[model samples]
Target: MFETLSALFFAHVLADYVFQTAKMVQTKDRFGSMALHTITVYLCAVVALGSIAWQIAVLAGLHLAIDALKVLWVKTRDDDGIKPYLADQVAHFITIAAIAAVAPTLWADGIWTKDLAQGGLLDISAWAPKMMLLTAGAIYTTRAGGFAVGKLMTPFAAGAPTESLPKGGMMIGILERGLIFLMFLAGQPAGIGFLIAAKSVLRFDAASKNEKAEYVIIGTLASFSWAIAIAIFTLAINNGLNDAPLLEIMAAKD
Candidate 1:
């Protein structure tokens, strides 16, 4: 059941975060756009959940239904804020959990497993589960975390200056979180301090008494906090999945 849940959640993260595009999100209220997003979800679920065609279909169908309702609710309320985003995500999670509960066999007969048998891309080694978990963690930390933190900062961003470089903030957050994730996995947690210090120094001005400064501080803190939490949690899970400690696992690779 745990394995099934992990695979399903991985698939969900990929479908909802990594694969979802800005265009898909922007026009999701339209039937064609919504259906396209659902197809992406279905394809991801198929790869993760394997030959359980009926179960995968159910999961995708539920996802589409939930998304549709969320779009309608948001449109009616004219609110595309953090609250609705969080609620929609929670609903999708519940749907995934329900599917995992009923499809425990998926872990054993999963598509990845079949691929391994066919001399395909994946190898069913001891690291296989950890690899999947790490992949999911990476995506969540960089992509999903960006959306979450952006929503969180929405209220504070009103009337703020718009003289910054285009897409600069988004790219910075992505790279920051990605680096933090790697540093933690490499057992070099202290490197984060240097990264933070560098960022602060680069952003520091002769004076710090303005909305722009405060805004940057808030976004930076939120991004750092989210990345740190995810990295720690991922490391804990990775430890549980292995007989060796994290350091020892790294040593073996050396």
Candidate 2:
């Protein structure tokens, strides 16, 4: 069940974050754009689930239904704020979990079983699950996490710098969260202190206004907290994939 959930969750994140483009998001109400996005979801499932099966169809079809409903709700309410965004994501996650609960054995006779299951570097089947979880972690910590933080920080945006470089803040958040994710993966949480200190020094501005400083502090804390939580969850899932208890894995790492 965990395996299935991890794979489907990864596919969903990949489809929604990485494969999905800004134009696709903007035009999601259109059938062509929605269908293209659903296709991407289907293909991502094919890769993550390691098979072409009916389960994948169910996953994609339900995803399309959820997205269609979200679009309809947004149009009816004439609002595309964070409420609908978070709700839509929650719906998709519930759908993924449902499918995972009943998903069949995807790796038993999957695409990777024939040519690559022998072992070693070519044994994709052996590593694909962990890879999926790790990739999902990376995407969530950067792209998805950025989107979430941006939405949550909307109210506080009034005090943010108006003269900043184009997408500079977004880029900085991505890099910061990515570095945090890697640090957790490497079991070096201590390094995050240095990262925070370095950023503080670099962004030490006129020291006259505190609004921008407060906003920056809030955003950084949110980003770091989200990255850390996701990183721990990813590592826990990876440990489970390896058939090891979380405590045992941590102990071994130590």
TM-score of each: 0.80, 0.85
Cα RMSD, model 2: 3.4
Candidate 1 yields a Cα-based lDDT of 0.77
* Poorest lDDT segment (10 consecutive residues) of candidate 2: 245-254
Pairs in steric clash, model 2: none
State the lDDT of candidate 2 residue by residue for 1-254, as single tens digits.
66776788799998999889999999999999999999999999887766788888988999999899989989999867667777888899888878876764665446654464443123466666767778888998898889878987887778786646899889999999999899888878888999999988877782236768788888789889888877887777667667777533241132
Taking every candidate in turn, the Cα RMSD to the unseen true structure, in Å, is: 3.9, 3.4
Worst 10 residues of 1 by lDDT: 245-254
Candidate 1's residue-wise lDDT over 60-86, tens digit each? 899999999889888999888877887
**Candidate 2: regions farther than 4 A off:** 116-123, 206-208, 246-254
Best by TM-score: 2
Give the top-scoring candidate (lDDT). Answer: 2
